[model samples]
Target: MTLALTRDELAEYLHEVFPQIRDDFAIDDLSPERITMRLLTAERHLRPGGTVSGPSMFALADVAVYAMVLARIGKKALAVTTNCSLDFMRKPEAGRDLIAECRLLKLGRVLAVADVLMFSEGGTDPVARASMTYSIPPA
Candidate 1:
């Protein structure tokens, strides 16, 4: 499908719909099938060992997919996560932002599925992975 929203429009819509997380994520890139997002890691995003926290990584995965959906479908803030499977692998590198690369596996009328791979900024290996399914709002 063609894009319903451009990258800038998607970013604006995300900020309008989710002000609470607006500062935490940045849309680095966008395409028809994939989105690249960055988590602006801060002290609050780190664990005791200074690595990015699991919950923070999960948030990146969640928002990245959500953004991807909105980019394709336009402003559907009601779309919600119906299911998620997440795996934490290695510790994230210290003092760097976290990056999540997400691809939409399915974008049906009622549901959307996304696969995400997360890594510390500039790192080659993934630190976490997630698969998320979202329930799209009926038109």
Candidate 2:
């Protein structure tokens, strides 16, 4: 399948919608089936236990999937997360940045589904996983 938005396009859209987080993540890879997001790790993302915070992981996964959706459907900032289930499976590396691998499960006009696996940079195993559904505002 042809992709409507490329990595550069996603970055531009991200810059427009979320100026704060635009500096936090970068589009590492974009494909018809999936996307990879890299977090620019910082002190704020770490927890007291020397691990990445759960909220940070969740945000990474959420934005990663959200960006993947926008890549296919174009700018739709109103598209918001309706439901999400995240599993924190393991400890994350506090010193390294995070990576989110997002796969679009179902993309339609009103609703979309995507799953994300988050990994600590320089690691292969997923530290957390999330499944999210988005509600696309009516045009």
| Cα error, candidate 1, residue 84 (Å) | 0.6
Cand. 2 Cα-lDDT: 0.90
Cα miss at 91, model 2 (Å)? Answer: 0.5
Clashing residue pairs found in predicted model 1: none
TM-score of each: 0.98, 0.96
- Per-model lDDT: 0.94, 0.90
User: lDDT by residue for model 1 over 1-139, one digit each (tens)?
Assistant: 6889999999999999889988899999999999999999999999898988888998999999999999999998999999999999999999999999999999999999999999999999999999999999999
Quote the lDDT for 106 in model 1.
Answer: 95
Candidate 1: Cα lDDT at 91: 91
Q: What clash pairs does model 2 have?
A: none
RMSD per candidate (Å) reads 0.6, 0.9
lDDT by residue for model 2 (4-49), tens: 7888988998999899996789889999999999888888888897
